[model samples]
Target: MASCAQKLLEIIYNRRSIRKYHRKPIPDDVLKAILEAGRQAPSARNLQPYCFIIVRDQELKKRLIFSEWNRFIEEAPVVIVGCGDSRAKWAVVDVAIALQNMVIAAEALGLGTCWIGHFIEEEVKKLLRIPEHIKVVAMITLGYPAEKPGPRPKKSLEELIRYETYE
Candidate 1:
């Protein structure tokens, strides 16, 4: 067994952008934990101006996936839509931080998540009846993963790092 910090590091290293998911629905408590993680995320000036929409209805999920690459969203048991207030200066940034927290929390809890950024925002807002004042910043799919993918190649630290200025 690994220590808490070790376990977290392991989870971070192993986390994947899971698209294929099992049909099992996330437990109420687990879902709450995930949401709480997002809620706890820090926002600029402590505004935290964001709303989350939980979608489990098959029809709605089916309608939300507009891209072929994101079609797997319809198969997941849960989808979390992060909406931010356009009036806020850092609305989308706040929502993005929260969404990343949620994704990490889901991974730690034995669930998988995939952050989806491409979609028809207007269509989604119209379908969900989101207020005109709110902006649909991002969407995420959550469920038990059906596939385990190997790690993809990554750039070396030396290649990406610079000392003081552009190298």
Candidate 2:
């Protein structure tokens, strides 16, 4: 068995925002595991003010693709709608942490996930039938990858990090 650290590193390195997916449905167990990870994520002050809607209907996914950076929603078997409860002040931060957990969990389970951003407040609420008190922060397309994406280029640590303060 791989050590926990090894598993974590694999998840961090292998996970990518996969934009294409095979036309195959994800098994129930895997989807459950992914959702479980999101549920276990830490929230600001543990407010846990997020709700997830698992969308599988082809038509709904099609309608969702209109959101920016979310074209893949039209093809993936499942798209997770991350919603935040506006009644709670820390809803946005809580939802973001939960989404990251879901992405990492998908990678660990040999699944690919792509995060769709561009939070058009009104449009998403209507699409998912979200109540006025809930805010839609992001969407994620989940499935087996149809095409393998090469590692995305990144800035070196020195370029991204500062030892003490900005000079």
Candidate 3:
């Protein structure tokens, strides 16, 4: 069996919010595997109320480049829009968890991914023709990484972690 610690660290540290990507397309099988990982993520009451909109259309992607953070989505081979069913109380939270699962899975598969914030939710909903009943939680650009990001500075354990109680 794989060491859980090693696997977890590998998935967490290896994953980067990639901003640059190769134009080469990802295989359908790889995409399916990533999506399956998301589907398997635990959700509130198992109410996996989320929808994925996979956008590969160049024109549509270009039109989606309205946000500064999402400009790279236009060049990626695939962009996944994670939408939450508004009826579920934990819809956004659940989709966020699922999206993280998908990101880690993509890293394990040697694919690069970046989580794009839903800065223009209303515009994006209209552009994607998504129903009002769905909330656009997040978006992600997926493809082969063009560049590896340098290790970003992180808060030390002492600065971030609190022992039992918040002191």
Best by TM-score: 1
Best-to-worst order by lDDT is 1, 3, 2
The reply for model 2, stretches above 4 Å from the true place, is: 67-69
Q: Candidate 3: misplaced stretches above 4 Å?
A: 1-5
The predicted structure with the larger TM-score, 1 or 3, is 1
- Which prediction has more favorable lDDT, 1 or 2? 1
lDDT of 2 by residue, 127-166 (tens): 7789988889888889999888889999999899998779
lDDT of 3 by residue, 56-131 (tens): 9999898778767668888799989999999999999999999999999898988899888756899889999999
Candidate 1 lDDT tens digits, 1-167: 55988988998889999999999989999999999999999999999999999999999999998889999999899999999999999999999999999999999999999999889999999999999999999999999999988887889999999999995
Ranking by TM-score: 1, 3, 2
The lDDT of each candidate is 0.94, 0.87, 0.90
Looking at candidate 1, the ten consecutive residues that score lowest on lDDT are 1-10
lDDT of 2: 0.87
Candidate 2 to truth, TM = 0.91
State TM-scores per candidate. 0.94, 0.91, 0.93
Q: After superposition, how far is residue 29 of candidate 1 from its true place, in Å?
A: 0.2
